[model samples]
Target: MTEEARPESPDIPAAEFEDSDLLRPIVESGVGFRVTSSLLLLVLLTGWVIFGRQLLYGLGVTGLNQPVAWGFYIVNFVFFIGISHAGTLISAILRLSQAEWRRPITRMAEVITVVVLAIGAFHPVLDLGRPDRALNIFTAGRLQSPLLWDVSSISAYFMASTVYLYIPMIPDIAILRDRGVWPHWFYTFLAWGWEGTPRQHAVLERAVSILMVLVIPIAVSVHTVISYIFAMTLQPGWHSTIFGPYFVVGAIFSGIAALMMVMIVLRRVFHLERYLKQVHFDYLSRLLLIMSLLWFYFTFSEYLTAFFGNEPSEMRVFFYKVSGPYAPFFWAMVVTNFLIPVLILSFRRTRTIPGIFIASLSVVIGMWLERLNIVVPSLANPRLPLPTGYYIPGLVEWVMFAGGIATFILGFVIFARFFPLISVWEIEEGRRLSVAETTERLEGYLPDPLPSAPGQPVSEGG
Candidate 1:
């Protein structure tokens, strides 16, 4: 293709190309962006200040005590990490499947993975009270410990997912470079001299293909390793064989919901109706619905196994979640993660943007609750006959939680300010090429025209 016909070509007039909308967030700034980013920054700063207090005062400042050692930090750690799965896994799956509709959604999905993963990775440090102690996991860490497994798996995941997120962005970075977007040197460096040549496109495509395949297992294993932190223990409610798949399902379920919410908000804020249409919402909501049902299945199987076994140690922890102080959170998780999502997403009428937003929000809340229920109740009801433990997050923990959230939002805000949240080049490729590709694929699904009826007149029947 000529330079003029290249998808990333700067010679193409902005008026003619629909993808200029994707560039608006990067090139143009307005009052709302400033206000929103400022608020998020304030929250992030407050969170850091509270974290500083924790550093000075130590774990004594938090609700953690006795048996219930982990609190909001670990819970949020699991929850945020689970949310991180929303990006790379889904984007990789869609890309691997060659889903044409994935073009507009994958960029934002990948962003969620990298940012949320970073935040989630920090939670372990926060849990350590003294951040410096985390170094022990590297210097004095044991291979047998699940904690070490967590560090290794999460670190690998962060690296792989970051590279996965950056590789496909090179073309768009090159476009910004050609258009003389600000920070020219930055884009020029990241672009690596991308000129949209056939060889360059082939190399980029091959690298992306390899990363997508590799990322799926890494994403799955990240959550499975997280689950191992609990399952490898002999503690009540934690010693279970099914926790691996269960955690993975929960991760993807929560991840999809999180991704959906991000898409809806960005779609509205950026006025991207042309790119993120109703069909995108419909398709993603359906995936969310499927995940909801799967999540319920895993949840039910887990609880049912414990209930049927009637193991005394497990029953105590189980009852604590079902009827004790955590009951509210447990049932609320059921309602939000399963009932609300299923009900809202089941019907076409309720699967609209507003409805999906509500469902997605509920799932996000419910998944966090699920993490809380999983972590707290088990610890509160120890297998030993020790006194029952309790936890209520201190102000510092709450602030830190808020900070984690603010950091997530701020990451996206900062990213939007610097780069197109939507993948311009991919969207252009889909518009130019996917239709014919899809048509051919669909035609392949049909019988081969019954061998053309032995070439009897070679009928081109309507």
Candidate 2:
């Protein structure tokens, strides 16, 4: 196969070998990467063991019961799926906007989307108590049901996300294929005969553009449909019209937070300080801060509508969340989602890496509580004559939860082990083209450069 021409980025060091060093994760002698990956794999196995145990003992071995039956599994399912948005949606937006800083971050973002989506999708089957019969969604399922929407949209998203992630990696994989990395045949196959001809490069860019356009709507639809599961219901908190946008906003909020944490972790682990610089973290934290404010606004708007309407059933549920049994979690959600992030990220002095890390972690915890707030309180205090219900996830659920996280970490580690976490070609391409590309793009916005002083030697097209 013909080797693709490697464009040199001026910003990259002259040695060109530093690029090889960046590729070291895929081709080196690193003890820590191996040991940590092994540890994470062992933990992931425990999660699978829990899944198998639940399959054997049936759903009864866990804490699920009346009203609160949608427990930690659903909460985490939503939370993880929400985290998936942090990757593809933001990546697509940044890419479409031609944001230069996105180059280093999009790869991890898409990886997060694919990995966590697989994890999140597992929960429905876990909730089912009989996962083998999952195909019955086709045999005994109704398209009219909201569950079908979740199934269908999420499936579409998984397929699209996988393709979206894989296509862009082709040139990079081809790089590996040429280098004759240990997995030579694997990279060769994924590279898909990409010769990186000018025409091929054009086609690749066009394909990414089309997919970028397509993925944004798919991503939005995925979360909107998820919200529909609650909005379509008649439950007190779930029945609001704002539920759809609220959930989407919360998804992006948690997603940005999760992405921030992932960014920080990956930066530290792979020694990607040069690529994933402080500015990247600072810019991302700003987005996280914006989402935090939006989250607060939605939370306020949602409660204000409910509280002002004086809907007795809604108020009952509201009071339970605000002052009753779930009050601690509710306020904790507030503190983490709003209070901590705003306090830390709002000020320039506190928006440093550590400050952002604190906010990001707090936002993640807060968002989990937000998911819990949405899923549990209303169900526990259903309007029916049934007595108050509560849910506390037993060992199986918690184990499975921990396992999913371990699986995510393991997936990321394995991926980094095989491939460069940052896109080598994209960064190089940016370094070569970003200045001129940016200049041309900005020139489009300036009204023909003030008409070139009316006729005083207009320059070319200007």
Best-matching candidate per lDDT:
1
In terms of TM-score, how similar is model 2 to the real structure? Answer: 0.94
Backbone N/Cα/C clashes per model:
0, 0
Candidate 2 per-residue C-alpha lDDT over 20-76 given as tens digits, one digit per residue, 9 for 90 to 100 = 666888878489887998898888788888778788889887888987878898899
RMSD of each candidate? Answer: 2.6, 3.5
| Per-residue lDDT of model 1, residues 1-462, tens digit only | 544445454423435366787888888877878999999999988888888888898889898898889999999999999999999999999999988889999999999999999999999899995687778877889989998899899999999999999999998888888778889999899999887777788799999999999999999999999999999999889889999999999999999999999999988888888889999999999999999999999999999999999999999999999998889999999999999999999999888899999999999999999999999999899777888899988898889999999999999999998889989888888877789889999999987854665647765686
Candidate 2 wrongly placed segments (more than 4 Å): 1-18, 449-462
Model 2 — which ten-residue stretch has the worst lDDT? Answer: 6-15
